[model samples]
Every structure is written in C-alpha cells, then in structure tokens.
Target: MRFATYEHRDQHHVAVVDEDGTLRPLSGVHSLTGLLTEAGSVPELLDAATRMLDAQPGPHVSEVRLLPPLQPPTVRDFVTFEEHVEGVRRSVDGAAGVPERWYAAPTFYFTNPYAMHGPHDDIPMPPGSSVLDFELEVAAVVGRAGRDLTPRQARDHIVGYTVFNDWTARDLQSAEMRVGLGPCKGKDTATTLGPYLVTADELEKYRDKDGFLRLGLTASVNGEVVGEDLLSNMSWTFEEMVAYASRGTVVRPGDVLGSGTCGNGGCLAELWGVRGRQDPAPLKPGDTVTLSVEGIGSVSNTVVPGADPVPVPIARRRTRERP
Candidate 1:
C-alpha cells in the first residue's frame, strides 16, 4: 500500500493511495505517525483503508496537495556507495578511494528534518550558493524501533522506502568542510521527499537473491536527463546503515535514513569528477529537477529564490595592543 500526507479542505490528512492512484483517508487516523507508533496497527489501518477503497475513490491524487509522507523524528543520510565516496574524495582529499574506516562500517551524518519539502514543491536556491546541486538517492523508513540490532535483525525494522533528493549547496559545503564541520548551510536549506511512500510488501518482487532490492535511478533537470544509476550498486546495505544508527541509541518509527548518492552521476559533484563541470550547468531559479526510482514514485521540484537574501558575512578589524 502507498501512503501519503495530503492537504484538502485547508487541512492536512493522512491517506492511503490505492493501486489505481486514487486516495482515500484512513478513517480515524490523523497521521501516519500515529499508525506507526505501535505494532499491529498496519493491518487495522489497511482494513480501514480497504473499506474506503471499496467505496468510490474520494479524491484523485492530482487534486490534493501532497506533503512529505512523514515528519521524520531524525534524518541520517549515509554514504554507502563506494563510487560516490570515491568521487567526492577525489575533489576534497585529492584521492579517489574510499577510506578504510568506511569499509569497516557505514558512516552517516544527521541532517535537518524540519526543512524537508514534498513532491512538486518549489525549492529555493540557498542564498550563499551559486553551485546548488541535487543528490539522487533512495531512503528507508524505520517501521519499528530497536537498538544494537544485528544486520539480519535490523532488516525487520524497515517498513518502506522512498525516493530522496538531497538538495545541496556545494559552495557552502566545500567551505565548511575546510573547518572540519557542517553540511549545515549546504544541505539544511531543503530536501525533497515523496510522491508517496511505498510499503515493503509492495516491493518484495524487486528484491534480489541477496535480499537487496534492485531498482533503477533516473534524474533530469529542465527536461534534460542528468544522472542515472541503480540502487543495487551500494556496497553497504540499508540493514547495516540502520544497525549502525542504532549502535548506541534507539531507532524510532519515522526516522528516515538515506542510501546517499548512487554510483551513477548522482550529483553535480560526482558528474564533475567524471565529465568535468563545463556543460551541465549548476542549478538556478526556475530550473526543474525530477528524480525517480523504478518501483518508488518520482518527485520533482522547481528552483526558486531564497526566502531572504543570504546573510552578510561579519567583518573583522585588528586591534592594537590593549586599547
């Protein structure tokens, strides 16, 4: 079953999207958050959902305003693709290889969850960024909560997946890394999520012999295809990423964890490594970006001006002795 939070009648509602692309509200349920908090609720939620579907569809998907499927309690994006890691390292470390530590275990960073946008939303180019880019990736949503779980055990915790576009401000990211911190201003500006969230059961057919789902990745800007990849190329698995996240802390429902950039030219940074940064220009206002995965739906966003102009940098002056 596909799920989403959409706006109708000036209020947001949690809805189940049927196979026919019709949406019907889950009776008595206010948000996906509530259904996810406890076990055995999905079946009940489905029964209620089915009842609504049994009747005529309440709304066609196009009529309602779609919102991010869930308000994630936390968002951790992991760099698990060796190709992406190697590409980024070449630009920053002057080496094109994954760090030994990364092979030992998956590593990730926490990003702002509140600033995320939904499908078809307008994303502002960060005020300080002239090199805005998009990271094409996929994300797994935590269905159940646990800590210190093994890879096999962690697998059960994931309930579903979604296409994730980690919008970036490359200029700000490059500068902050020099000081050994951030991705703050670089990424927190916005993240594009949804079309809708697909449940794990719906994706069982896509799983390979090794239990990883095989899916194609595609992204285009202003109707031009920019990047492409497959989800199966990651060296690390979502179970591993989830287990690593739960090593010392609890993983909760609604916590979103991403697969980072795919091996294909998933972003301008990686593309620059392969093709150089000459022809495929950086994003600007009015440019539209659409990202999609095989089974999961596609999400598109248009670039727009920042909410406010970039804040000016503070000026400094030297003082003489002890004035």
Candidate 2:
C-alpha cells in the first residue's frame, strides 16, 4: 500500500492511498510517531492503514499537498556507488588528487534536516551557485533502533522507500574538499524527498528473479532527458550500507539512509565532462529538474537563484601527503 503525509485545510496528517485513488486519513488510526518509531511493525500498520483507507471517502488527488512521509530524526546519506565516486575522482585527479581509501570503504555524511523540502516545492538555488546539479537516489526509512547490526539483520529494519534528489553545488563542493574537510557548504543547500512512501511489501513484488531490486530511474532538465540508470547497478547493497551505518552507533526509527547518486545516473559529471572543453549546463534561474524512480513517483521543482548576492569565499587547500 502507498502512504503519504499530506496537508489539508491547515493541519498536517498522514493518509493512505486506496485502490480507488482516494486518500483516507490515518491520523485517526495511529499516531504518526507511533507508526514510524519501531521496526518490523510498519507492515502491520500499512495493512491496517489500507483497510482504513478502503472504508473512508476523501478528496481528489489534485486538492492535497504532499509532504515528506516521515520526519526522520536523523538524515544520513551514504556514498555506496562506485561510479559516482570514480566520476568525481577522475574529474579532479589532475589538480586536487584522489584518495585511495575512498574506493574501499563505504562513506556517508549527515545532512541538515531543516533544508529538506517536499515533492512539489520550489528549490531556491543558493546565493552563489553557478554549477547546481542533481543526484537521483533511493532512500530507506529505518524502522528499528539498533547498533552494530549485521547485514542479515539490516533488511528487517527498513520501513519503506522514497525518491530523493540530492541537489548539489559543484563549485562549492570542489573547493571545500580541497581542505580535507567533508562536504559542508557544497551539499548543505537543499534535499528534496517524496510524493509518497511505498511500503517494503509493495516493493517486494518488483524484485527480479535474480534477487535484485529492479527500478528504473530517470532525470530531466527543462523537459530534456539528461541521465538514466537502473537501481540494480549499485555496487554496495542497501543491507550492506545499513550494516556499516549501524556500527558502534545507534540508528533509530525514522532515520533515513540514502543510496547515494546512481552511476552515470543523474549528476553533471556523469552526463557531461566534469572539467573540459564542454562545460556542464549548470541549472539556470528558470530550469526545472524532474527525477522519477519506478514504483515510487516523480518529483519536479523549478530552480531560482537566491535574490541577494553573496561573495564566493576563497578555499584554502591542505598540503598533507596522500596515504
């Protein structure tokens, strides 16, 4: 069953999408936090939610504002895709150099939750961004709290799936990484999630005979298709990412784990050269980017540069020897 957090009138509430395409309020059935605060219970809740949706009558789809399904306590994104890492590494090899360990370990970063937006909202391009790009990703909502979880135990902790667009500022990212610091300013601008959350059981039917999740992902800029990739190409599985993330730390319910950018999937480096004669067509003031992942829905937003002008800070590089 499909579920969503929606705003009707003036209040925000949870709803379940029914077979007849009607939305039924789940707020009366269960508390939003109670539905998402534990593991292995989402399936039962979804079943109950579906039954509740089948019984109630509600407004048409065009009248509701869809919000991000879960208010995750912590938003963690992982770089488990080798293709994206390699693409960035190759682009900066001549000037900035690449790290050896980056290819071996699964790396991740914590993003600011305050910057997240829903599916149909307008994404404001940061004050000094001339090279804005998009990352198409599939994110998992954690349902259980745990530490040091094994790969076998990781799958059980997932509640559902949602499409994510990790909007990025390429110029800022490059400059910031030169200091050996993580992607702070480069990636902190905005992250878009939503349309709806599909429960794990609803997605299970789409799993291929080969035991891999089969989902088609596509990205478009101003009605032009720019990148396309499959979810099956991921080098590190979601279970592995979850296992790694849970090591020595507590991962709570409603926490999100992003599957990084899909290979040659959605970023500018994957679509065009990172640095070359042909510069990527960075998003302009009026460009609209739409990301669609099969099973889950599509999210489209228009880009507008920030109104006020701000100075671009000069970056200081670290001279430490490479390991």
Candidate 3:
C-alpha cells in the first residue's frame, strides 16, 4: 500500500493509495508520522489502514495537492554510490578518485528536516548561491524504533520507501568543505520528498536475488532527461545504511535515511565532471527539476530566485603581546 499526506480544505489528511491510484482517506489521521509511530508495527498499521479503506472513498491523488508524506524526526543522507563519489570528486573538486576511507563504510550527513518541501513545490534558490543542483535518490522511512541494530534487523524497521531530492548549492558546498567541516549552508536550503510513500512489501517483486532493488531512477530538468540509472547499482544497501545509522544510537519511526545520489549523471556536478564544465549550466529561476523512481513515483520542484545574502562581519586575526 502506498501512503500520502495531502491538503484538503486547508487541513492535512493522511490517505492510502488504492490499486487504481485513488486515495482512501484514513479519517481522523492527519499525518503519516502519527499513523506510523502510533501503530505497534507495520502489520498493525496495515490492518488499520485496511479498515479505513472499508469505510468510504476519498479524493483522487491528482485532485489534492500532495505534501511530504511525513515530517521526519531526522534526515540522514548517505553517500552509497561509488560512481557518484568518483564523478563528484573529479568534476567539482578536480580530484581523481574516490577517497580510500569512503570504501570502508557508508558515510552520511544530517540535513534540516524543517526545510523539506513537497512534490511539485517551488524550490527557492539558496541565499547567495548561483549553482543550484538536484540529486536523484531513494529514501527509507523507519517504522519502528531500535538501537544498536544489525543489518538484518534494520530491514524490519523500514516500513516504506520514497523518492528524495537533495537540493544543493555547488559553490557554497565547495567553500564550506574547504574549511573541512560542513555542507551545511550549501545543503540546508531545500530537500524535496514525496508523491507517495510506497510500502516495502509493494517493492518485493522488484528486489533481486542479491537483495538489491532493481528499480529505475531518473532526473529530468525542464522536461529534458539529464540523469538515469538503476537503483540496483548502489554500493551499500538501505539495510546497511540504516544499520550503520543505528550504531550506538536510536532510530525512531518517521526518521528518514537517504540512499544518496545515483550513478551515471545523477546530478549536474557529475555531468560537469564528464564535460569539463557546466555544460547544461546551473539551475536558474524558471527551471524545473523532476526526479522519479520506479515503484515509488516522482517529486518535481521548480527553481525560484531567492533573497540576497545578508553580509557578515569578517573575523580578524589578533596577535598576543606580553600577556
């Protein structure tokens, strides 16, 4: 079953997607976080949703505006695609290859959950940034709480999947990383999620013997396809990323784990790596970016100009004398 949150009569409503693609309103439920976290488990939530479906019909998905399925408690994005890492290093930083430590384990960074946008929402260009870009990836929504979980255990905690767009400011990211710290200001702008949260069982048919999801992922800019790849190409599985996330910490329901960017031109930075320059150019006002994942659906956002940055006073070096 696919789940979604939509605005109806100015109030948020949670709905389940029917086979025909219509939404079945789970009356009284306002958000996916409440529904997902309140339930004892995924099976119990499904049972409740099934009962709701038996009650009455709801609105068609096309009619109601969709929002981010849930307001995640935490959003951790991992760099699990080797090809993406390689391309980014070569193009953005003019480096040759992936870092040796990158192969040791999956690494992730936390982004602002408050900054999330829904599918079809307009994305504002981050302040003081000119090189806006989009990343095509998948995200898993944790349905159960757990601590110190193993990879196998992590699988059961994931209730569903969704498409995630990690919006980025290339120039700002470059400058920040130079200080050896963050992608903070560069990435905290906007992260798009939605269309639907597809239940894990719905994707079993697409899973391969190797445990990889063989779904297709694509990103298009202003109606032209810019990037494409298979979800199966990921170096680290979602289970692995989740397991790593739960190490010595707790992962709660509604927490999101992103699969990072896919390979083969997943983002504009990768295209610049192959072309030696920004061939397609950076995203500007009026451009739209659409990222789609097979079985999960798509999330699209249009670029809009943002306010100019408010200048900050520069710090000055001081010399100590006869202290």
Expressed as tens digits, the lDDT of each residue in 62-145 for candidate 3 is: 888889998999999999999999988887789988999999999999999999899988999999999998999999999999
Predicted structure 2: lDDT = 0.76
lDDT string for model 1 (1-323, tens) is 89988988898877888778788777666767667775423454455556644344568789988999988889999888888887766654456667788888788899999988999889998876888889998999987889999889987888888889999888788887877775678888898889888887778898888767899999899988988888989888888889999999999988899999987678877767666443477889999999989998999999998866656766677675684
The C-alpha TM-scores of every prediction are 0.91, 0.87, 0.96
Model 2 bad stretches (over 4 Å): 29-34, 38-40, 47-55, 92-100, 208-211, 274-280, 307-323
Residue 234, candidate 2: Cα error in Å is 0.6
Q: Model 3 Cα displacement at 214 (Å)?
A: 0.8
lDDT of each: 0.82, 0.76, 0.90
In terms of lDDT, the poorest run of 10 residues in model 2 is 89-98
Of models 1 and 3, which has the larger lDDT?
3
Ranking by TM-score: 3, 1, 2
Local error of candidate 1 at residue 75 (angstroms):
0.3
Candidate 3 local lDDT, residue 99: 98
Best by TM-score: 3
Per-residue lDDT of 37-152 in model 2, one digit per residue for the tens? 63245666565565555355666546888777767778888876667776666653343333677667678999877777888778888756677888889998777777899877
Give candidate 1's TM-score.
0.91
Pairs that collide in candidate 1 are: none
Instruction: State which candidate, 2 or 3, has the greater TM-score.
Output: 3
